[model samples]
Target: MYMSTILKIAVRNLTRYTRRTLLTATLISIGVIFVIVFGGLASSFKNSMINVITGSLLADIQIHKKGYVESIDNLPLNIFLSSEETAEATKIISGNPNVVASSPRIKFSAMLSNYAQTSGVRLVAIYPDKEIKTCPDLAQRIKGRKDLSSIVNPGEILVPELLFKGLSLKLGDEIVVVATNRDGAVNGVTLRVAGYSEGVMGPSGKDGYIHIEDATSLLRMEIPEISEIAIKLKEFKYLSSSYKKLADTINGDTFEVHTWEHLTPFSTIVKIVDVLILMVRVILTSIVLVSIMNIMMMSVYERIGEIGMIAALGTLPRQILSIFFLEGILLGLISTVVGAIVAVVILTILTITKLEFKFGSMNIALTPGIPWSEMLITVTIVMVISAIATLQPAIKASKLEPVDALGHV
Candidate 1:
């Protein structure tokens, strides 16, 4: 039989049972919509997280002592660079044109106390001037103060809003911060509460800031010795080149370079997203398989007489098979196209309204638009499943003896 003849019979047979065909097609469409909508949402969330984390805490790249990261939880000051080593590392890093700004930090954990309450806090000592240029948003999030430009006093600190609210803290409150120094000696500082700022999203792990000078004095840090360097690039496009370039130029086994993704633990959420997508694919594919296969099997039973007549009239068994296969493929194409359009329209509306929600401590804005690649892959899965589901019935119909099918009621 001609290809056109098989298609005509397939479409005609579909229209003969209009309601059933529509129902099956609708189920497939729903599955497609589920995959596309959920996939788009996962992508949007990851993008929002990346923007927030990379913009502040993670920056673009980081430099740290080789063994320091492996035992980062201890705040191991012993693994840190010496004053002369830090200066040399700074010189090599600053030589790169890709570097826009770099800031040195000393990160430590301390117990902060006001007379009435005490809370354990992570403290990041920053060079206020350099950090301001590096993270401009930090300047904007300053609550009580207009900006972070001035060093009002030596022991002033900026607390996160969450911690501030929990501790019932007020500006100009004198607080005591206690910690163990690198030499395993007890150290403490009485610092004035400066102001509050929005918390950073990534792993700088600093809920509060004091001047680098203040930290050095309090912790007895050597001159020019610091914990790590946070680096920003002129453009994000420079990330790959700069990471390799800086590593080669620094040329030291004592230090390791890392990107923001490696620095922030939250980045592991990307793997979680992948697992979710895979589960979704399995669910939607199951829907297509069961729904299409069930409908096609019913179609075979109802059309047995017609199938017999066509075969008896000298139409080949392969031709009979082609007719059913074409019907399933056409149904898949129609449903997938409709479902994709619906998904795009809905996603667009949500994006335009700028729908947002908070998950845990992070705020996420639902970004608009789907990646065409994701949609294409999902539709392809539906089509492949449709082919497989229809194949079993198609094969059964092809093998049916004309005399036996004609004898059916």
Candidate 2:
């Protein structure tokens, strides 16, 4: 028999029991939908978390003074670049096409004390104009403050809302900040709380910000003694390339470069969640594979007499095997198409309706949406698994004795 005749016969045989075929295909479709929807939602969640963290402060890459990351606890007061190095770095970064913008920042741990309350906070002295350009939230949240038009403005600062709440501070309240200078000398300065900003990070929400010059003068550090260089990029995929280029151009002993992934440990935890979600999707796919295997096996068994008759009537054993394999392939293709369409429709409806997610202890109001790329991948994986699952059954059917198979059926 010709290959086309065998395929036609196999397809017709599949259609003969429409209900069973439909059931098997439906199960495969369910698995595919699960994988696609979950993969998409997980991706979205990770992206959202990244936006939240980056929006609050840290940019895509943070270039810190050498040894600052490793020994943040015992920060070396004088471990920073000179004026020339700072100018050089600024020039290179500003010139790089991949670099969107860069801001120089001075970091220190300090205690903010009021009449009735005292809370420890990390103090960041940032270039206001550059910070506003990259982080508009900083600009938007400024309240009870004067105009901020320069990097070396006299007395501008941003404090987090939590700090304000903890100290019962209203706008314009004078807060005393005690910080250690570059020479390990403790110095205190009084700065009016310029504004209170909200943050996604706990520490950031608890900390305070001061003007570049005011913070430098208070900390008694030279204007060139910036501790970190925060940079935003045109694209995140360019992060590694930009970082490598910057590192190569600068002396490694003088500065260390880090991406947002390294700067914020929270992103790492989110990545771990992504891995777990993928593993769950694989497990679901395996379940579908097992179901497909069982469907193919049963299909082969039920058609033993037909297969034997075809083989005995001058059809080659290999051709008989090919027929069974073709049946599986066709079933998989049909399932994939149907599953993709059904999943898309379902997801669209759910998205339109704004499906509410209510897990055991979490209630999140978000769309359960899947992207087209994820849908395509899910369909492809399901089809491949289905084809692989049918291989053993195809081989068994091909090796069967014609007489015995015909007699049993």
Candidate 3:
């Protein structure tokens, strides 16, 4: 009994029950398509959200004082990097090949008064040149500001849209900002409104920007100090490796480095998306397992007489088992190929349509696609489950007695 003969018989047996075979194959194919499409959409959405966070505000990586982030909610001003520490961190960051730009910021909470109304706002004081380079999309988030060269200047402030609308502030309006310094002393400075900034997360965000010089003046600092350093990479794909290298080089008890995922609360949403994907995969596996096993069991029962004839005609038990096993493999292989082709076509259509949806205040377009490795893994799992599903039926057919099988009605 040659392997070719067994395969030919397997094909013949499948065609003999064309309707059943097609139904089983269709079920498995549907499972594959569902998993591929769902996984692709989920991945695209996750990546888009990440890009929004990283590009607009939180750059790919951030370096902060050891305790700065833990108490970030309060915008603590006392725990800051001194001028010497900032200089050292900047030097190390500049030397890293993966870092495209880094901006040192002084963040604090301040009360903004437009003379008629007052609001509490979180202010991030940045050097315009360095900040623009580190967060390229930061300028885009500012309403009516296209020129990145002058995002914010000395004695100027970029206020959040919520604050701008709430306080009825106009460009060039003089606003007084009162803040407490690290020395527990309070000071106030008047600054001109340079522009209105769009919130990164939603409309409720109260983050604003100002010039480092003005921040120092308002805080009454004798020397410049930094709260954090935001770093950008040449590409998002370099995130993991760049983070590892930077952490290895600069992280210590005094300073800590973190990726954008670690710095934002949106990371919890990303994790939930991942768990959903895994659940989809598990459902797909169950579909394949049950469908293949049911088909194989029915196939074995229907061909008992045929099995007895083959066994009595001197066919080897191993050969009979091989035929059933090959049928399962062929069914899995054909269905997987069809499902992959159809999935790719559907994904291509989605990409061409440029499906758009809203996330917060931003309109996001989905670019759904599956990696080759993921597709390969999917195919492998289906085929392996197919073989396992066919095993009991194949073994049972091989062990059937010629007398008992032939006597079946």
Number of the top TM-score candidate: 3
Q: What lDDT score belongs to each candidate, Candidate 1 first?
A: 0.81, 0.74, 0.88
Candidate 1, which segments miss by more than 4 Å at Cα? Answer: 83-102, 111-119, 129-141, 148-155, 162-168, 174-180, 185-191, 200-206, 231-253, 257-265
Error of 3 at 230 (Å): 0.9
Q: Estimate TM-scores for all models.
A: 0.82, 0.88, 0.95
lDDT tens digits, residues 315-385, model 1?
89999999998987788888899999898887887778887887544567888576687799999999999
Ranking by lDDT: 3, 1, 2
Clashing pairs in 3: none
Poorly placed runs, candidate 2 (over 4 Å):
1-3, 73-76, 137-153, 202-204, 349-370
Q: Rank the candidates by TM-score, best first.
A: 3, 2, 1
| RMSD to the hidden true structure, all candidates | 4.0, 3.6, 1.9
Report lDDT (Cα) of residue 89, candidate 3.
Answer: 88
TM-score of 1: 0.82
